[model samples]
Target chain A: MITFKNVTKEYPPKTHALAGVSFRIEAGEFVSITGQSGSGKSTVAKMIFAEEMPTSGHIHIGDWDISNIRHSDIPVLRRQIGVVFQDFKLLPKKTAFENVAFALEVAGESTKRIREVVPHVLKIVGLGEKGGRYPRQLSGGEQQRVSIARALVHRPKIIVADEPTGNLDAITAREIIELFTRINDFGTTVVLVTHDRDIVNGLHRRVITLRDGKVSSDAEKGKYLLS
Target chain B: MRSFFRIIRFALQSMMRNFWLSFVTVSVFVLTLVTVNAVIVLNVLANASVKSVEGRVQVTVYFTSDASESTVKNVQSYLLGLSQVKDVSYVTADEALAQFKENHQNDPVILASLDEVDGNPLGQALKIRAYNAGDFPFVLQALETPEYKPFIKDKNYNNYESALRVLSDFSEKVRLGFLILALFFGFIATLIVFNTIRVAIYVHRDEIGIMKLVGANDWFVRGPFLFESICYAFIATVVMGVLLSAFLTFANPAIVAFFQGVDVDLVSYYLTNALPMFGAQFGILALLGLGTTTFAMRRYLRV
Candidate 1:
């Protein structure tokens, strides 16, 4: 579960990215955070990961208060919440499998565990046959799937997907969204932050819309709305 | 145990993937360590030679020709009593003439000249050896004390004193000069190694960024590079040590013959007493390998 209590993030010179934004994401729920560029959707994701601390508010994931967490402990927080970026940040030199295994390796996972878990995640992303291929060898959609596989290695309780299909074609983006839906069906919570109206309308999940750094709408089985 | 192996496997894979960058990094480490090792060996050899020469230099106090045998013996006994004097051997004029004849036996002109010195013209002298080279000058100074002043005549004292002073001063200067030269090379080596590592890091900036983004721990990311550097330095050290030892062991005789009139055989003398050189080289290699890598890593890899 994730909770934002009056979270305010302000850059210097008084530019408020998130002004007293408050919300809660319950466990095992698939929810979309819809906002245009610079509307502070990514800021919300960053705050959840503690990449940027809230300027004047309490942010909680489960029972942990991450607003005051030290930089060294950020990785521990990251392990619990899988994050997918707009750009699939895979190590180019590594095979798709190596890119996924790297996530487990950094966490000091046993080779046996990495060997077992990596293929399972790749299979879920439908790249089980392409594990040996490097990132450059894979399609853009396939690369994003590899990143998703990497994020799933820890069996994280929540996935924070920021524009998961931003760079993909409409069909490929639909496939990625369908993959998210499948992952959520397996009892993991998914928080998708995107401006893709068609995907949001297609999902028919709970949606939270942001307008000018504030939550504009919170609807169950919501349609995409620009505020 | 398994986790550690995993880390190692990951590191090895990463290193292999970034081959050229790793090679550049390790080569820098090797070059720095080699320079450091050479300087250290040279410093050790210089110090050891100076100490050997200093230890061997004996002050020969010649007595007056008119001095009685009993009086010369008293003077020798007095010189032996000094605490600074390690050993004193009294060589009579007859013994000196015999020693001179034996030394010049190969040279007929010198042998004839030595035979012409009719009735043992050399005086009875006391040859004094000191414990340490540094103690030689102190022993010379102690000879001029009131207690031994009467025994030390001006007959041969001035020349011996100046010679001793020159040798001691030269040894001190050589020691200081080697130290300065070693430090200069050390600085240059460090800078070269630092720049090479920096350049390598610059070349692999993307890989490093990828590693960081993927959540590699600082040690996990740094360990392979550090190990590579240490391996390079260690191999270079072994190679340099073997080459130096072989050169000293095999080339010594030829070098001694070349400098036939010199007191020290540049090679054999160093090889014979080379424990310090080994210690110095090993120490320099470790310092260079560890110090330069640690420094370069801190500056470049902030994490």
Candidate 2:
């Protein structure tokens, strides 16, 4: 579970990235955070991973009060919350297997565990057969799948995918979304940060839409609408 | 333990993946060591040259005809007592005349002139050798003491002054120039390494960000670059050692022939101290490479 209570993240010179953004994500739920560019959806995902801290108010992932997490503890927090970036963020030199294995390796997982978990995660993301391929060798969708495979390698409780389908085609985007839905069905929390209208309408899941650095609507089954 | 192995594996993979960068870094390191070793060789040669010149210089203090043999012995004892004078050999008037005749035996006129002169006209001499060429002046100045000044007809200190000055000054200047050259190359090598590592880090900046996002610790992120630096240092050191060995082997004969009577055993010198000397070079290169790599990675590690 993650909670943002009246959280505000302000850049200097009076620029507010997120103004008193309040939201609660329960465990085992799939949540979509939809907003325009600069609407602070990605910022929310970054805060959840402790990559950014709010200027005011509270942000908690489970019982860990990450609003003021220590520098040494940031890595520990990151290991628990799997984050997928918009650009895939795969290391070019590492093969698809190594890219996924790196996540577990960073967490100091045993060699046997990494050996076991990476293949399982790649299989989950439907890239089990192409583990030997490098990032450049794979297509855009396949690269995005590798990124998701990396996020799942640690068996994290919450998977935060920030515009993961941004670089993929319509069918590929839906495929990635379907993968996330399947992941969510396994009782892991999924926070999808995207502005894709069709994807958001198709989700039929809980959605928190942001506008003007504030939450404009919260619905159980939200529809995508630009305001 | 597994993490340690993983770090080493990553370092090897990174180095191989960026083969050209590694090669360039190691080449710069080898060139830096080359400059340093060149400076060391120049210093050893200069020291040997100075010593050879100093050995050739000896001031012979000739005594007047009236001075007795005992008086010459007293002067010789006095010169020997002085710390600056390394050795003092007393040459009698008769012995000096015999040496003169032996030297000019090919020139009959000079030999006949020396034989015709009445009963050993050459003065008794005290040939003084000083420990250092620079100290020769002080040894000559010590002769101004009232004890042996009156009996001493002529001191040959001024005869060797210009030669000693030239030898000492030239050796000093050569040593200084070599030092400056060594430092210049060292500075250049440092910059080349710093820039090379910076470029490598820039190339992997995105991967570094991803690594951090995946929960890699600071060491986990930096281990590959740091270990790669040590690898470059190790390779460069070995290459430099082999090159130096080959150079000394092929060049020693020419150098020995050029130096004629001068004692310059470069092969022996390097062979005796190769371990500690090359160990220091490797240590310094590794330290410099690590420092530059750490500095280059600082901005990228912010994530």
Candidate 3:
């Protein structure tokens, strides 16, 4: 349920982060946007979340145009799409439970709803037993799971994981990829942006490859096609 | 309403988690109030002492011995007519001599000199009190009229002028010095508060960024820090009030004894204006904290 038509984003002094890109995904489609570093893959995820605006062209998530979204309206858009960063951006002081509950709390959810939903979501990401632990006390995989749990807390229709497995060990990375697959099987649209080839070939879903600020390929049931 | 309570709860939890920083912020606030209250107490003591000295100042006007008692009484009446002259007393030559003897009774040289004068060398004198120490010069000028100056031998205005000048100058200098001290301490307090909030924002920068990513509005992120600052201000004010009350209770007796006869009742002054005074302090400090928090957040709090 997201569309980027003829989208071009440029930085100052002739730096093109993204150029002449067009993509569309129907509701409940899992898509992988893959490329080498600086190939504008992360820029796609940033556009979906309205962190970076398209310099030219149109972007529509369902019927809402976010090509030039207002700063005030960004929060409402963000609530509908959960974002998972590579570094597991959890508040260091907050416990695992508080960290997950924070997303609902920020949305003005009632204490009763927050109490009911936070544990359930954390349990979905397999962090229910370690809810009392802080980020420092948890391992990298556990911390990443906490991030995934936070992203799922609001039941956002689309989950955008930007390099979600970048810091984890190989086995842990595989587990996180499988977790994304599980999330996708539940009919939530998942856009995984990464450079990891094994994860991309393993998924065998819709893959959009970018090279030098342009989309080089888009293939259904695609393999890791980049050198 | 629930979000408002949540913000307050988050502020308290943050305060407890960063207890040392909170303690430092509150202590700086208390120290600033200490400087302010010290200035207030010193101002009160200086004013009372200056007024006591001013009350004792009187100008003595000596009339020639040949001047009649009626003439001296007439001069006294004229001096009393001036608004500058608060009171005037006419001392006959005999009374002046008796006062001189009583004052110099401990000094034989003064007694021998008085006896050698043969018949009350002292003349009738007018002791003039002015409403203000600064008005003595005006009062002395008023006495130089032809009718009054012909009978007058001398006026001891010079002695009171130098003393009043010193007292006035000292009082003004003390007040100026204290004001400068207050300003210096106030600047330090501002910087300390600015840095404290900056560090707090730095520590929570990640959380702040993530909160925005997770759909929090700007006020949602800002409210907790603002409340945290107010919490520090509130606690600091309560601590300062307790300390000041305890100090006045323990030190009031010593202060009274030190001034001896001068009226220095700090307890009554503080007790009377305690609410408005400390309340103003808390307001000022809380505003400072809030202002600094807002500024410090400008760079870090994007949401």
Candidate 2 lDDT over residue span A50-120, tens digit each? 98899999999997898878888888888888888889888887899999998888778898888888888
| Top of the candidates by DockQ | 3
DockQ value of candidate 2: 0.70
The TM-score obtained for chain B of candidate 1 when compared with the true chain B: 0.60
lDDT of 3 at A28: 90
**Alpha-carbon RMSD, candidate 1:** 5.2
Could you tell me the TM-score of candidate 2?
Answer: 0.86
Query: Model 3 in CAPRI terms: which quality?
Result: medium
**Which 10 consecutive residues of model 1 chain A have the lowest summed lDDT?**
A70-79
TM-score, structure 3 vs. true: 0.85
Question: Which one wins by DockQ: 1 or 2?
Answer: 2
How accurate locally is residue A129 in candidate 3, as Cα lDDT from 0 to 100?
93
Pairs of colliding residues, candidate 1: none
Across A83-163, the per-residue lDDT of candidate 1 in tens digits comes to 788898888878999989988877788788899999999999999899999999999999999999988888999888999
lDDT of 3 by residue, A132-178 (tens): 99999999999999999999988999999999999999899999988
lDDT of 1 by residue, B121-202 (tens): 6777788786654566666776666654664454332234455566667756765666666666666656765665566567
Instruction: List where candidate 2 sits over 4 angstroms from the true fold.
Output: A225-227, B61-98, B101-161, B299-301
**TM-score of the second chain for every model:** 0.60, 0.80, 0.84
